[model samples]
Target chain A: MLNPGSLTVIGLGPGSPAQRTPEVEAALAEATDLVGYAPYVARVPHRPGLYRHASDNRVELDRARHALQLAEAGARVAVVSGGDAGVFAMASAVFEALEAGDPAWRALDIRVLPGISAMFAAAARIGAPLGHDFCAISLSDNLKPWEVIQHRLLAAALGGFVMALYNPLSRARPWQLGAAFTLLRQHLPGTVPVIFATAVTRPDERITVTTLAEADPALADMRTLVMVGTAATRLLPRPGGAAPWVYSPRSVPAS
Target chain B: MLNPGSLTVIGLGPGSPAQRTPEVEAALAEATDLVGYAPYVARVPHRPGLYRHASDNRVELDRARHALQLAEAGARVAVVSGGDAGVFAMASAVFEALEAGDPAWRALDIRVLPGISAMFAAAARIGAPLGHDFCAISLSDNLKPWEVIQHRLLAAALGGFVMALYNPLSRARPWQLGAAFTLLRQHLPGTVPVIFATAVTRPDERITVTTLAEADPALADMRTLVMVGTAATRLLPRPGGAAPWVYSPRSVPAS
Candidate 1:
């Protein structure tokens, strides 16, 4: 039997329409309904005859359930996210809702499209800060206890991995990044490069390369993504006339 | 005075026409001339009335020089790369050539449009294997010394950074990946999650998640992009009716 109901989770790729892949556009064009966080839905340019279901960010499960319900009713649906659907985004919620709901949803076809993540965009703009192995951890501790985050942070720092700090801090979680910094300092050297990339791939983008010791807690916010490079992550001048790029030096050249 | 000649570097995003972003499409549509590595140029569907220049892979300088010539003649030119232009791709070459060329060529406006990097595409298929910090390195060392690559590898391994290995191995460079793995094993634990992602964003796409020690060097080629995750990377089985996903557990929940 033809699969009448299906879901396509599309990554918007940073925030630009130019960055949206053709596959994502086609999926959006073919979709009868769009479900996502309210702000994400607003980003799509005006399109008539499209049904939209938008919810606030906190109720991800609700949003996923709604999308599945629409799909179940034979609507072609697209669940959208800003960066990538699978990277700390809506794909998990969709899966969670599916697992928690009727087994019949298993028969529905689903596809996930990749988008440019903020860390990669940030790295691209500031050279190859992520040229070495690294890890990303959110400073916020709503679902997970802060202790769990500390354990990961200590492990990442001791391992000498570069780090991407998502949700570094917010008004309510003002000291979260500060606390993380303290733990990081215990393991990483003081001179490690820390890149603060804010609003990457957007018009108001700001990038700063500093040392781990000098990364001020005041500079970060919810929108900021912090990339702390390993010992090898260095700031190199744009070679003569090239745009400045951060490259992870190779360990060994091909013989 | 208006910059009559402009340079645009576009990313094709995993070789699929469907995955090509609108911005990239518009750039290609607007360009009077196109320049890129031979295979990358051939991947684009044929379009009439446009000048196309393809060069051997190793001769990046020559490709940049050709693109500059077109731009100098007041043509809207696009230098294309397979993935994001900034990620170990053509953006650097374009700038390098401009810098090494006459001062007049350096004055032209240049824009880089982001595309879906292969690792991002691969990460999405396997469930956020790159949710943490990561690095991308090319194994080939025609330009740089192998020692330099080895140094970077040691730093990445000691630091616990996730890694994406491009140009892992070819007929001539059969032992490169093996040697690199040997060095990596010196610092990183053998059980670190490793994935071989091939033909990303295409119908024939295949992804296999194994461990660094278990990774089969024979399975890799130029077309394959390999992702090596940190110790934290884990595979989650589909809960009854969901697709299996790989994710780096983040400290914070969606807030």
Candidate 2:
């Protein structure tokens, strides 16, 4: 008899209940096992039937394999990711495991649910720095090399593409973000706006919109989503001394 | 007397109610007037005391101005977009209008509520095409020139970005997507996967996953979100002939 086991990879959407979709909420409610990075898994409240398995951030593949194992054992598992799981998140790791694992796992029901990405969440908090063409690069050299990051940063800068930098800085690799900024400045003007949004949509949310010239790398941490504006990006001054609205206009100037 | 009016730009995620966030649902329930392009505005169910103002897609700035004007007159206005408003949607246009319009509009209660983007929705429908480094580019030449789109596309392709392309083609610009595929072929391997997800997450949704060599531009329309994979992208076959799982692994091999 085939076990009625299934795995759902769901995104919680940047630490806010409001940001999560009705689909993910339903998945979370029906799940027998919850697995994810420690902080993200802890975000989901404990219920008697839901067994939570929280792991450290570095062990994404191991966590994914464990979740798959639980599902294979006839448990309805929900592997959670903070933002959209598809974007440099658990969805990738799950698929990687599914490929390298047992062929029977392929027959198991699996689905990926999208969520509000931290980059888009941060962009929403600011006026829409990603209003135009933008690229999202992970600044963590853990996965790729520092050289790849530098090359992509320079290419994005030269192409006049606005950028969203994820995993901008952490204890393991602190200098990568600063070095990226330095390389970007070589191609982009100093006046370009760089926004650092930490713990976006959470209570400790701090949004600092500064220019490339004065931007401090120390302002960002692992929770931060950094956005670099294109030359066409405008910072509209708000009355009553509120935070200025920054947006990239839909139209680019005729070349 | 202060007007209790407010303006909220909300995204109706990819034509699916399940994909929409709870925050957007609350905003919709509270809104007195809904303003957006005709198709998106039509998505909202009509109720007593709620008014809908739908217009053509070409007049985003004008529609934004109208929404602002409604909010100025004490209307609880919801300007809706199909995907995340911050991503090539009404938010940028609204901010553009806010910057150019009267100063008092800034003082008005204007906020951007994030929603699930079409790109992510499409990515989830497949496996995780955007699992690694990614960029989102709009191929519509209505706002920007074709040359700029070409430049950004080339840059993203060269930088090893798994790209989520919006507005891949329409009647006005038929050849842009084909030319893009050609440009990509020059830099990327012909075996790279290109996915066209049309009307993603909706009743009429259609997905076509093919390689760069076999990709047909005719498969896409304005309602489609196209994904072009990088060299690192993989397509894992499944048991019993299900659609192949496509994803980019989190780690890149050392250069």
Name the TM-score of candidate 1: 0.77
lDDT of 1 by residue, A1-255 (tens): 665988888898778776777778888899989999887898776588789888886677788888888888888999998877766677767766766687777667777788877766676666445544455666667656787678667766655456778879888788999898888888888888777778877888777777889989888877799877667655555435554445443232344
DockQ of each: 0.27, 0.86
State how far residue A182 of model 1 sits from its true place (Å): 6.9
**Model 2 regions lying over 4 Å from their true place:** none
Interface CA RMSD, all predictions? 5.2, 0.9
CA lDDT of each prediction against the hidden true structure: 0.74, 0.91
Colliding residue pairs in candidate 2: none
Lowest lDDT sum, 10 consecutive residues, model 1 chain B, at B246-255
Across B21-82, the per-residue lDDT of candidate 1 in tens digits comes to 78788888888788999888887767887788888777877888888888888889888888
Query: lDDT for model 2, on a 0 to 1 scale?
Result: 0.91
Give model 1's TM-score for chain A to 2 decimal places: 0.92
Model 1 RMSD to the real structure?
Answer: 5.1
